[model samples]
Target chain A: MLVCRDLVKSYRNKTAVSGISLDVEPGKIYALLGPNGSGKTTWMKIVAGLVKPTSGTITYNGEPIGANTKRKIAYMPTEPFFYDYMTIANVGKYYQDFFDDFDPNRFEELIKQMDLNMTDKAKSLSSGLAAKLKIAATLARKAELYLLDEPLNGVDIIARDHVITAILEAANENSSIVLSSHLVDELEKIIDNAVFIKDGSMVLCGEAEKIRAERGKSIVDLYKEIYA
Target chain B: MFKLMKYEFRKQLLSKIVILAMVGILELMFIYGVIAEKANTVASAVGFFMVLAFISIMFVSFECAFTYSKDLKTKQSYMLFLTPNSAYGIVGAKVLTTIAQVFLTGVVFGTVIIANILFMAAKYHSVKEVIEVVQQFFKEAMQLDIQMDLIVSLLVYMLVYWILLIVIAMFAITLTYTFLANAKFKELVSIALFFLILWGVQKIAEFILPDLAHITSYIMLGATGIYLVLTALFYLGTAWMLDKKVSV
Candidate 1:
């Protein structure tokens, strides 16, 4: 479980995340819905401890986010973040070297499932393949919390199924997955919770089914409604 | 910590290989010159090797500094900061890796130069006499005693000074990336800060040891201790800023 209280991140005159507070419970998939510059990535980065919030408190379980929390939280950044020298296999080894929770066998299996060669250079991979590689590397870790920023981005429709399945497999009673994506319909089916963010603030957040029953609209429709 | 150091070394491998490869080729040229008794070729090789030694040492520090700056400026930082490692550990590994590389480079160049001198001494009987004459010339001209203990102490002092220089550069770079990240001229700012930090450390060293003209074992040890303390402060300062302030 993770909790962020009144988080704010400002870059010079612009505010990336503004006074947003939220709790992430265990065993559920959270679909963070937003347009570009909606603070989803920033919030996720803060939770992952990559970005320090301008003024706020963020914690994993009861402890503040640090090296210890990092051990339990696996973050897949939106960008292609692997070293240029890394091959797909090297990326797996890198994760193994850093994270004790990383499972190399699972990484290899996911790499094969994603249809990527072990020796393929990460820098040379197509964007779609790169996304799959990120997913495989992240999901290979049996972390307590997974922060995936736009996991479905650049992934094709057919490959999306594989990605979604891998994501689902990574989520269990002992773990939580917070995923941000623009593909709301694809996510609506799989996500247990939906958090709608706009203009750097949370506009709506609740159980996906409860919101559906009360509002009589799909997550995609809500996305359009809120943003429009 | 060692894992981070390993990756740091890995990141530096290409640069090291290129430098060492050049050194290797030059060594072969020197050997060929010696075998053929070509004075011009031998002199050229020695001169070029000296330049390469200076270039290689400068290149190593700059390369390491640039790597840190690149990590902060680009998405590559996630490859490092995403690990369950603290900023202190990451910075420490980088510093250690730089020292190891400099040490390796020193050893390689030193060994080659010493071996070449010894080889020349064996071949041309006057080479040993030339070394003694050069030592005598330095002692007479500079009034500096060239003893083994003094040479060893000077090497240690130079090593400490180099480490401090690298640490100061890292601190300035980290400051620009973190606290001054939004400034218009962050690169220029870092450059200026680099000099300022160096000057500040120099001033502090002067304060601690007012007279450095006459070098002694105690003076060398004292200077080394001062430099190391300053290095640690800047190193820790950089790591703290990186952990608490840096967004990327």
Candidate 2:
């Protein structure tokens, strides 16, 4: 349940997100499809309250995004964003310290499921393992909305399935999940809706199956048509 | 705010072990210097002051540079900024933690120095005479008027100065790093731009407020307050920029 109106983000003279508007409904997985520099990450960051819009307003469930709204949203960045010296246990403790809804037991369970050691420092993990750890840590929160940026990027094919499964398990009937990734085919089986963005604007957005049925094209075909 | 502060304290605690160990080594050196003073007072005093100067410089530089740079290099800032806490809370926690660490280290070092001086003095003089001698030495070494009120005020001023310097430096470093991280010519451009900005700010401050040297301590304190306010403004600016401008 997030709404963004006339959201525009620019750096100096270059416009990264040019006046895009969108609404996310609860209990649905929305796959944000965009090529590199399409402003998908910008939009997600704005919605997560991590970045302020240059000229726009974002409301979470009606009110403006603030501390209360932020408490309900969990954002996982695409980069490896943790202290080098932080072990999995310390990272868990960090989450526990910051977010009241963070479930330490769930975090440990996720770590075990991912076959990651709690004592291993985050920096020492491989990129795939790091991505898995990031995903697991993010999903351990009892947040109402989850914004994951390129969670599957650089991960092995086998690990991709694990990440997707973790996302599915983390998504509850009352919660909404927005994920951005280039792996469209993998997302096709799980995502309920697709929002296609190109050149900092939304080109296509609707129910995934309905768009295919109405347009006689899959999400991948639609992606090519919009960007190419 | 308390939660944020507690986390900040913990982070600093884990990272400052190396610094604490260095302080420990310096303490041992101070003890050795005092113990060997009878053989060579001038040499011992010179060695002690040299070590003191080295420790102070290293501590200040390390605290200023690495505290913020490590966060950027490690990308730990994402976790920090994305928390539900306010930017003020985050920056304030960092400033407070640095101040706390420095203050605690100063206390420890001061106690060690005092104990060493007292032990050396007791070897040659009566206990009362030793106490007087130690007091006199402190009064002269610190160059203060030796009043309780003056000492308390000086301590407070020093604490504030430490906080303001660390906070301003951190805000500047974090902001510069964030802007530079996504730039085309990252390392060189960032360093050049940072120095340019610093130069520009200094020039502006000088131009706006001339005759700064002639200002009284009270006026200097006021100016320090203004600097702190500016530091807070920079913290907010950095936070806004990161939230809105950052892509990665």
User: In candidate 1, which residue ranges exceed 4 Å CA deviation?
Assistant: B118-144
Give lDDT tens digits, candidate 1, residues B14-44: 9989988998888888889989999888999
Compose the digit string of candidate 2's lDDT tens values, residues B108-222. 6677667755676776566778788767888889886556654554565555555545555665566565655455644455456556655665565566556545544554565
For each candidate, give its TM-score against the true structure.
0.95, 0.82
Q: Note the chain A TM-score of all models in turn.
A: 0.99, 0.97
Best by DockQ: 1
After TM-score superposition, what is the CA distance of residue B19 in candidate 1 from its true location, in Å? 0.8
Q: What is the DockQ of each candidate?
A: 0.90, 0.44
Q: CA shift at A153, candidate 2, in angstroms?
A: 1.9
Candidate 1 Cα RMSD after full superposition onto the native fold (Å): 2.2
Residue B65 shift from truth in candidate 2, angstroms:
6.5
